[model samples]
Target: MKFFLWVALVVFFSGCNNSEKENTEINGDIVYDMYKPSEMSILMNEMYDYNLKIKQEILEGKTPVNFPTNFLNIYTAELSEFKSRNETFQAYSSLFVENQKEICNTDAHSDISERYNNAINLCISCHKTECTGPIPKIKKLLIN
Candidate 1:
């Protein structure tokens, strides 16, 4: 009788494990539903990384020379479901691009540090109205 009870318990545990495996598999393949960021989200992350590099270069006393042409995609990249490309967003984005250009196209009188800081400020200001989540991270991009 004890042997039979042990066998029953083993079978129950085995079945439970198999059921869990089945739940995670589909047609013999394990599939995961990963969160895919929107086009605008991806672009924004790239922009942040690019700006961080620019900030480092500026701190090192080097002016950034390459303007990421892809930055212009902000005008066309698809935003998250909750965000819209409204007039305010458009205006801020335009200003951000202009500031970025100033950082790359250094003039004899242009202060690269100030231009970089202005670009970072535009990012902060835009986020304040649209997506407040990234404001803190964006603030770190400032030269000072």
Candidate 2:
């Protein structure tokens, strides 16, 4: 009876340890997961839309341009959605500073440029640490 009890205790403790180690797991099998593929596709679509807006903003010489009205709103919404998904998928903690923080407070072109650069850098930095496969495209986004 004592030997059986000891074995049970050992098994219970091992199970507890395993659960703790895998507590904050991510769905790494995103390729196979239906939701992940759709989510990634949506995020890419947003990025493409955002790229066009970025060009327009550069031409207009403004940060968060509202010329087309609702453009900024949609862009921000899409960016936030993608970022939220990325954060949720990351198992470990990561630091992603806001690149748009200063744009709202000021309307300076240079400040916008700086904020944009920082934001792109944040993407590059996170990708470098998490997914090195997209490093080339990410690096190209930075202001050289």
Tens digits of per-residue lDDT for model 2, 43-121: 5446536644674575577556332333233223432122353543342212332343433446556656666666666
Q: What is the lDDT of every predicted structure here?
A: 0.75, 0.44
Evaluated at residue 40, the lDDT of candidate 2 is 40
List TM-scores for all candidates, in order.
0.74, 0.44
Report each candidate's C-alpha RMSD, comma-separated, in the order given. Answer: 13.0, 14.2
Q: Could you say which candidate leads in lDDT?
A: 1
Q: Count of backbone clashes for each model?
A: 0, 0
Q: Which candidate is the best by TM-score?
A: 1
Least lDDT summed over 10 consecutive residues: which range in candidate 2?
29-38
Report the lDDT tens digits of candidate 1 across residue range 25-90.
Answer: 579854432335668878888999999987888888888788999999989998645456899989
